[model samples]
Target: MSDTAPKQRPQYRNISVPQILSYRLPLAAKASILHRVSGALLFLCLPLVILPLFALSVSSPESFASLRSYVDNPFCKLIVLALIWGYMHHFCAGIRYLCLDLQMGNDKHSAKKSATAVFAVSLVLTAIFGLKLFGVW
Candidate 1:
């Protein structure tokens, strides 16, 4: 066969379900993308973070007590916990992406490793803070 005789190009248009999921993409890829999204959400959620600090720092003892009481309430506690998860997830994911930027965890296995690291850090942080918030720590 001649080199230029009816050369056929390979087709690259097929996709499979499992072929899509574990195709060996980097762990840091999804983590980094989610990190950016979470960071944006946390930024947009500033009033929620700042208001608590402001309420705690600037108010009188009684006012702070009132704020504390509200925070201690179950509904507020859950909301605060969700915010904590948001912040912790963003922080851990950010660190993972930073590692990726340093050329670490860019492979599929390494990326999964980094993602595991992200979850472990986020979970530990959440548990610590969660217990503290619930006065169990």
Candidate 2:
């Protein structure tokens, strides 16, 4: 065989980055992402909001009364509602993850259904708890 110069492949410097808005991710991926977000929210809120309020509530009778009154604030109510949602979503998604880890819902259809169920259960539970929090029950 005659040795000649090897052909070099052309290197095109154009790199195309796909637009995020045009990318459609599956429901299960969305649920998984939300699970992480909810967990983070719960973890951050525990020390910043809940613990301080809990400590104040148990400090004395006056403090408890003050805390009770504080809960009546619309802003505080909204924060509590958000916290409730975080807890519910985290709890439901965690259960879903546990089931997944156990090899349940491993199939595509079952995985989608389980993700949907996690969303529904968490939202429904949050709604019920929200109603009670708002004194509608």
List residue ranges in candidate 2 displaced over 4 A: 1-18
Number of backbone collisions per candidate: 1, 0
- The digit string of per-residue lDDT tens for model 1 on 1-137 reads 77779967857588778767766655566666767777887887787675666767577888777778778888888877877888999988877767878997678787888798897889899889999998895
Q: Which structure among the candidates has the greatest lDDT?
A: 2
Overall lDDT per candidate, in order of appearance? 0.79, 0.93
Instruction: Give candidate 1 misplaced runs (Cα > 4 Å).
Output: 1-30, 52-56
Find the 10 residues in a row with the least total lDDT in model 2: 14-23
lDDT of 2 by residue, 1-137 (tens): 35696877966475456555556988899999999999999899899998999899999999999899989998999999999999999999999999999999999999999999999999999999999999997
Per-model C-alpha RMSD: 5.7, 6.8
TM-score of each candidate structure, all chains considered together: 0.70, 0.84
TM-score attained by model 1: 0.70
